[model samples]
Target: MKLTRHMMPLLVMIALLCCSLNGFAAHGEKKPEKKAILLVAFGTSDPEARKVFDRIDEQTRKAFSDVEIRWAFTSKMIRAKLAREGKVLDSPETAMARLMSDGYTHVAVLSLLSSARDMETVAGTLMKNIPGRKPEDAVIFMGHGTGHHPADAIYLAMNQVFQEIDSRAFVRTVEGNLRELDISEIPFERPTRF
Candidate 1:
């Protein structure tokens, strides 16, 4: 077969394109972005409440071992709640800031607010201002999903925001919140005055 000038160039270009595509498709050729998991708990001074968050932290860590793990108490009000009753959170801020300064470049925050109200508002304010982090990428906040609370509607609303994966959003609450579908169904170990 006689090779024409145009045909010869076209064949070389096709070969190059094929090789590039195969290199991209190969596994281990490109590394997936590493992610970090942060579990945010409502600040609690109550011994029992501490246990609840501890269990939550443990479970979350186990579930996402591939991701770097971190924790934050996420709520000043909750810490105040425990303090007003003569209790103190052991390491709320330390845990939060340490995670920020540590090796993980991206941090996912999981809040323990019963209704996600505090996480969406108060916690939102601080997450925006993490000392050395970006609101859009560096820090992420996640909320525990409720399963038995009557306020399942709130969870539904939150689910809408957290659904977009590209955006820094999350949807979750304890299972009971969904199961009960009513606020009254939530069993509060310590009552809030407001």
Candidate 2:
């Protein structure tokens, strides 16, 4: 077969692709990589509220006994609000970067927030299109308690986003706010005190 100048580059590309695939196949089948668990939440400044977070941490540690666990706060506003009160917290980006730098190959993110947007972002980062690492193997996201706030329409919206990306993903709620909340029905003319 006669090879043209343009055909040379195409042939080289095909040859490289084949060689790469063959090399991967030659290494034989690999076992699933171990994963670390990252529990993410919108942290609080109140000492009393912090106990709830602590309890969640304790329960997660007990359940995932074999996995390495870490904590991250997804709210910059909440983090900043806490920092002003003389506390510091790590964001998901900061925590994940540190974990990757420490040679962690896989991560499973669990969000303690009613919303799934931040959790989805972390799951996306962990489950990237990298060679030798299956996206499904690297990460998972669990959104906790989609109720309790008047502004929880955000959680419903986020569930749709997760459904579009991964059918296995979902949102759940526990003990939602007791008050009947209908934004359209509520009259907002007067200033209310907390």
Candidate 3:
């Protein structure tokens, strides 16, 4: 079956989880693996943004029918905001703790910000979805970067991939020292094109 952009990340995550479980099983432990999937995201306070998470949750549940699925938010601020509004969300640590306590031996934590391959799929999807996009029109994607983490390199790699795919495509970070394409250098005649 052909994977959609939204499902690509989930498939990659499932493959990784399967590999991990297989490796653990190879160790000769007799305990049955109680598998679970934890979907982690930076999260958002906006109701509209929350819809994306809901969709992901629904899709994950459908994909892993037998496995339990849960969610955690990485952003403390977002969590706090939601909590104040009477919606409780768990942190990654708390979620993992709960999973362990519930006897989930094999828990796969899937982050919303996926690897370069998944990001490439998302970028391509975004470009294709743009209404009446032109060959000369540029598409710039802004991503939230982990300041000091090694994962920050993914942004750089994605930027390079975006450039390689189409010189008009660009990626920038909201919080990182990573060098991005200079927006000032790109001449923008039609504001609508952006």
Best by lDDT: 3
Superposed model 1: Cα runs more than 4 Å off: 1-34, 77-97, 113-194
Tens digits of per-residue lDDT, candidate 3, 78-130, equal 89999999999997767776776676778888877577778778667777787
For model 1, the local distance difference test gives 0.49
**Model 2 pairs in collision:** none
Q: What's the TM-score of each model vs. the native?
A: 0.34, 0.44, 0.74
Model 2 off-target regions past 4 Å?
1-34, 84-86, 113-194
The superposed Cα distance between candidate 3 and the true structure at residue 78, in angstroms, equals: 1.2
Model 3 lowest lDDT segment of ten: 3-12
> What does candidate 2's lDDT look like per residue over 88-144, in tens digits?
787766676665555455666566644466647644543454346432331223333
Q: Which ten residues in a row have the lowest lDDT in candidate 1?
A: 178-187
Q: What digit string (tens of lDDT, one per residue) describes model 1 on residues 1-194?
A: 86433352354344334433444554757534345665655455557857867787787778886888765553556766766787655243355345434433344545454455643554455445556543344223344444433434566665444433223333445543433233343234444221
- Model 2: how far is 13 from its true place, Å? 27
**Weakest lDDT window of 10 consecutive positions for candidate 2:** 137-146
